[model samples]
Target: MAPFLTRLSGRAGFRLAAVSVTAMLALSSCGGSTSRSAPVLPDGADPHAPEVTEISALTFRAPIAAGIIQTSRGGADEEFGLNVTPQWIESSATAVSQIVAGDVQAAQSSYFGVIDAARQGIDVIIVSESYASNPGAASLESMPDSGITELKDLIGKKVAVVSLNSSHAVKIKDSLLDQGLDPAQVEFVELPYGQVPAALQQGTVDASSAQGATLAQVKDTLDTVTIFDYGDGKYNGMAESGWIMKKTFIEQNPNTVAAFQCALLKGTEQVKDEAVYAEILKTDLGFDDQAVASDIAPEFGATIRSEPLQLNADILKKIGSIDEDFDVASITLPTPDNCG
Candidate 1:
């Protein structure tokens, strides 16, 4: 509501310096052919002259990270002639900067981030769909005594969000509009997921939008009530985020993109198995018992669809996030046949 809030402070700093060191160590240990055995290739392929491609990817500490982690650990990447190394990133803004600077080739970004980037003349293509929200997967939360029992109660109240340009913010704003409430009446403050619970308890913000493990934490630790569910009503099964690459990078490295897509498809299928997903949460992401139990795994897929992305753009436009028209198809890559 604050002057068509697009860019919010405290959400764009780079955490790359520390992550780059770790990525370098991982690359050194994993890059040597002598340290690891020969990769298994498709039938009738030459192992001696394997056309392996190495790519560095940026990821967040969210449920979507599981697929890529499993892909690398499950040997899907190696099997597809790729050495995929993932670096944990702080935010989508940082990922965009890294991609443009050639520090990383690919990253997991929200649909809102992609649309906002396009409006700013930064060309990035969606290579694969990573996460779609399930019912009640994202929500607006407030303390029990906040007197905010319904959407209308939030008028003139401050709501904390990760970013004003985030998919969560757009969804919440759209929901407010659908309820016939003027979204500008409520103020959106930017806060990291880790600080949301504290901010709510300390009375810094009236309520906050939460998702994934953070949502699970607030429900467990605080006497909070969900004012609204972002996945409910007309927004059920909405595509939230996906893997993206610079348009020029995708054009120059078609085979690499295909391989990454194939491996991601295989990895997504693996996470659909409950046991496998739980293991990745406990072993890889370090989720506690409650966080793991309450985590609503997003609907993962590899194929990029135009409809959901177009819906996202429309919502952003309705909320006054972006003024220019965007063609969803222009930034989407065709799914590889093997991905199916």
Candidate 2:
């Protein structure tokens, strides 16, 4: 059984988008929403409008960028366009704010957030599965010499995470429960993603749950590795990110949606290629040139179980453990056809 978390945890407009025909058509299908702050595309592709050769979509965080789906380069850079905008928000909770406010077109988010959003009547569709490991990738890390190899060892430990409502915190809580440890056995301190390593160094927190940059930082700076994954042998519902969309948008634009699926699915395949992936991470995603050329690229790929893995119903059920009646599936948008 996956440990239950106590709690868990966008779009742009067209006109400014003049990169590729595919991008223009994608944006054109989006229509116009002047009332909101979200990005607005110019009204469809005017034959008069110049052709967009490529478009840049943002990556939610660094860890997501490390996976096979991101590293591979087989996807249509010309068809779906290229360039991914990377964000600073490290956890699912923060990503939701930007999505609802229309800061970006889509994001890598916790399935729980998508479910919760659906429950709240937000029309969201999970288009793809970004990561799937048996134990899940989220874990507690401590100094090897700290003698803290087990969850029980965290009884009096100070742990750090981005925020209480963030996915990382939820992962920690679930990990503790999986080990039969009271979640409250350790004190959890909230810290920014950038500061997790420093907190550990200063002994401000004995350990922190890391993902992406924080995970990389821990390994590079402290040589830390996982104490244990929260999900252990099960899905634990920690299935990383789900690419989501607004319900209203999907209902109105089937053709456009299908185009996106075909393109992204192709991208997912490309992400699996190590050589191509390395190039995407450093160049398209904008990792430091030195980091890519010298350091190892992050590991990433789409989950095989899902053509674009859908959320686990059991995990959705578990989310209700904290928020009674929270049903993320209630707001699920229609799944795109022939996504496989």
Candidate 3:
């Protein structure tokens, strides 16, 4: 695969590449095993059959990561004749760079980031849906002392987000338009998830957007008031993120893609059990607070529906994040019959 130009500014690409390499080395040193037993195949299956494919994937600690984690931990990939190793990534935007550079074969990617990459003429395809937004899944909030109790209060203030034109940012902007407030008047500061709570406490940003573990962190650590929930109104049930592979990779490895989708589909179903989901949060994701784990509501699925995808594309264009029209269907790979 040819390396595509990264949109990351300055030496961010190099930094992310270094991180990816380091993660690979670290995972390899441990024999690249999660220590989970592979599922028992049906009668007459060869126990010593070789794995058909091996893939490196990019993931971070989030609701979406749960599915990937389960795929590895529950031995779904092994059952499907695949060896999948997930590398931890710091920035979602850099996933494209890693995939194009051949550092990773797949990534749990943001819906908005995928759309943005396609608009830049990058060839990427959504292999499966990772997570969708449910009520209270994501929100914009402010510290108690910030006096920002409503959406209108954010008009001329700074808001912190993980990405500038991310789905989080777009939802907040769309909400502002609903309130008759100019979203442009609100400055968006991009900060790492770990730094967002500190930034809000220090008054660096008047409000901040958060989801998944980060949302739990802010609520547990601070007495923040919600300005609005992103998963409300028209944004409810929107496509939040998905698993993506380069279009060329999909064309070259159709069976591998199908195997991945099949494995991930089982993983998605595994996480639906409350006990299993909570255990993953505490063990895999390092969530110390039991309450936080129980409080989080994740909507995991493997099917890439067209309606939610199209809604996100329309929002991106309405918010001026993309100039040209995009058909979400064009960027999606039909689920192979074997995936079921």
Candidate 4:
């Protein structure tokens, strides 16, 4: 019973219950074992002391827009009193691995990474949010000769995505389940994001599901079929991407975490403001005049329930095909009191 990412009432109980589980798991693990303890500041050391080194944050794309906030507003050194470096990864999978290895302090990851990480006991938390759905970015591009018009039309057709764990795959799965189609009836292939358009062109796959600037670029040439505009109606409540960090890091550096929140929330507010968005495009994002004029990014707001982010757990559970006995009510995390 998968619901579209649309508005659905009566889900608060489910979310709260899930949060309880997350909170328990997060807190209980603190006492279980410790191979390496969290870094501790020396006695008499100032907590607000300025940092001389950079903190590493992994990103999956070019360092622009929100990515700039990590470096320009205040590099890791200024924000964490420690230099914060932004490392770009080609895929979210690499970012997860880096975080697990303690190579990076934070990352902007796909929601799928969060779920997979939790399932693997990585002790991660969603600290902030970024983009959701952009109608222009969710194009369901198809081959010109595929004769595909709507999502339902591709009921049994082969669909291609970068990977089953990728956000594109989640969007494709959620979309198929929402349309009352048997997801297994359709075939899926693991094609890279850049090659999706070409795969569609060659009829290697019936369609390619991709989001963000990539979709915008290939929509016209691929004769993209508009399946569901996640942002068009109220379905935009879906969580497409957000900020995530290790639980141990958040506890050991509460102030740093707060500062991180302030900076990101500030960035969100700035991005929401039309004037600021313009400035970001012209200066921060470094987009050309023509591209900036056409691209419309999603607006952000400061709703920081970092510990327990507002997610569609029921929807996720359904799409993930989690068993009823999986007990989401016994498995979600809690929000911090300081989070707004």
Question: Ten consecutive residues with minimal summed lDDT in candidate 1?
Answer: 1-10
Question: lDDT score of model 1?
Answer: 0.72
The better candidate by TM-score, 1 or 2, is: 1
In TM-score terms, candidate 3 sits at: 0.83
Sorted by lDDT (best first), the order is 1, 3, 4, 2
Model 2 C-alpha lDDT per residue in residues 248-291, reported as the tens digit of each score: 55455444444444456566666666676566656555556544
Off by over 4 Å in 3: 1-52, 291-294
The deviation in Å at residue 276 for candidate 2 is 1.7
With a 3 Å backbone cut-off (N, CA, C), the pairs that clash in candidate 1 are: 1-184
lDDT of each: 0.72, 0.50, 0.72, 0.53
For 4-111, candidate 4 gives per-residue lDDT tens digits of 111112224224424544554565445322233222223333324422234566654321235334233433235435445555444555555555556567776666
lDDT of 3 by residue, 74-192 (tens): 88888888777776665657676677556678987778877766655556678888888878877887999888999888878998877765678888887788777789998987776
As for lDDT, the candidate ahead, 1 or 2, is 1
TM-score of each: 0.83, 0.66, 0.83, 0.70
Query: Which parts of model 2 are misplaced by more than 4 Å?
Result: 1-58, 66-77, 80-88, 134-138, 163-167, 230-232, 236-238, 284-340
